[model samples]
Target: MAVHPGDSPVHVALRTSDVDEARAFCRKMFYGPLQVNPVGDPAGFAFAGDVVTLGSITVGEISYGADVRVNIADLETAYHVLAPLNGSLWSRHRGTVVIADPTRAAVYRPVGDIDLEWPGDTRLLSVKVERAALERELDAALDQQIVSPLLLGESFDLAEGRGRTWSALVRLLHTELCAEEGLASSPRMAARWRDMVVSGLALTVEHPYGDEPAGLQGPRRPRTVKRTLDAMHAEPWRQFTAADLAAVAGVGVRVLQEAFRQHVGVSPLAYLRRLRLDGVHAELSRSDPWQVNVSEVAYRWGFTHLGRFAGAYRARFGVSPSQTLRERR
Candidate 1:
């Protein structure tokens, strides 16, 4: 997936029962160089294959003949990060253990040699995102090549048991994916699909180098920063202050402040506030105008103070809540 930051999305989906065909696609993508070391002899570990259909948002329609299992090294160098649409995968890379089962989500960087495996039967969706292009997409920490594997490196799983907001983000993407995917027709049919692809990619490939902790990508840890981040995520719109955060994290106010600065790249308040915006965006993105109330939507995301919320919401999203609600219909 050679990416141009502003370039649209390229989506590909494949299901193949033939190991040869699946392996071929993997080879074309990255597994060849990675040289997957299967646990047992191929004849022994191999399971029934799938009826494969390769779908694309870029490069158009490409057909595949069989189901495949593959292994590769230094994936971050080859493929751009493609967000996981469904299912689970187990992989190890970059001295980290990654277990991505979108329901729980496993994301890691394969800086060193890595091992990856696939489920006996799986349906996966991939969107090619070029790091070079992502630089143009936004000014996030992703401007540099993310060595963090799983998200972009060879292939890894999408873990499960994410915090509430992350879970909500998946629900939105899954909804759009199920509704418009089969009828996507062409690569660039509508912005909603593009938004779906981008949003999913951003949330899933979250790296710690920028503002998050070194491994805040998804493993369950009990550090104060981890607890603090999760707490803010749990209550994005809360009127949380630094002192309040320190109490939640069980650290001195200054210590927690420094930790947030070093790990998350932003102050605690800033992180929480941004998450609030994301929360609102997720709600608006998924809300059905015919069924949901607009003001109630704002209030739900902690926008009870109308004017301030409207201004902040408009500034963050480029569109007013009214416009967002109308479009949701």
Candidate 2:
């Protein structure tokens, strides 16, 4: 379904009476060689679902009329977070079992195979994130390559604190997605939303690298931070990696990262993201809404995910990019 980094989204809505058709749809949408077995009588079996994509992440809702068991050899390239909207789901990922409902959400890491049993009335709001994108975000945050597999825990508590906040964000995205034209439809917004989803997953889910220090051995320095900021302000559109910024600052990546946190109150990449966000805001504020799409201006400023970009823009400016464009118009 073109669920890759930097690709346009593929939207799908499917309802079928045949189990085989549902199985094929699941395999194609999730990129998993999955086996679906109805747990009970198939006489009244039915499947209904719809999915919306944002770059390498797919957010969707699905339900079945007949209870079923799903088996997968390996979800080789992606990680899935399934939060049930109604009913229940029991899952085992490489032997780690979790019960998924409204309060508890299931997290399936990329390296493991999975088995799931869904009740006949089970309905889920699923978030599927690409492995490469997750690793790339981690690499950017750490400023180093990660060679080991990232094994996340089986589930997270969605009833309280950060997990609840994350779920709310997901719901907000779903709401904006259903709008005829809104931030979720903008490329800039999707970029920011994608970043939030991946980053949020890493923060909320238990992973090995979650607590690892992200800075260098030496003390933080403002000069290094200034250098990185200068580069970002000069060329916010450049795909500048942590290594590249470190090179420009005449320091190691971790050192530059620490400098940014100490002096700028954010990491180097985050500073760059802010600059890009500002660029988008400025463009939207000056453009006519009818003549320019928020996605176009966001892409021009180097944003690739509309949902994320819109969320960040709203958080920063207290309004959506489209709102800014409309006011300007």
lDDT tens digits by residue: candidate 2, 1-329: 22345644457889998998999998888765789899868877889878877777888888888888888765657888999888889998754678899999998865446789999888988898888887776666653334334546678989997788888888777666656587767666767776788777766776533243253223333566656666776778888889999999999999888776655567888877867876786566556677899988888888888899899888755567887677554
Cα RMSDs of all predictions? 19.2, 17.4
lDDT (10s digit) by residue, model 1, range 294-328: 68877776666888878887775456777766754
Deviation of model 2 at 120, angstroms: 1.1
lDDT of 1 at 279: 67
Please give the distance, in angstroms, between residue 64's alpha carbon in candidate 2 and its true position after superposition. Answer: 0.8
- lDDT of candidates 1 onward, in order: 0.49, 0.75
Over all chains combined, what TM-score does candidate 2 have? 0.62
* Candidate 2 residue 162 C-alpha distance from true site, Å: 1.6
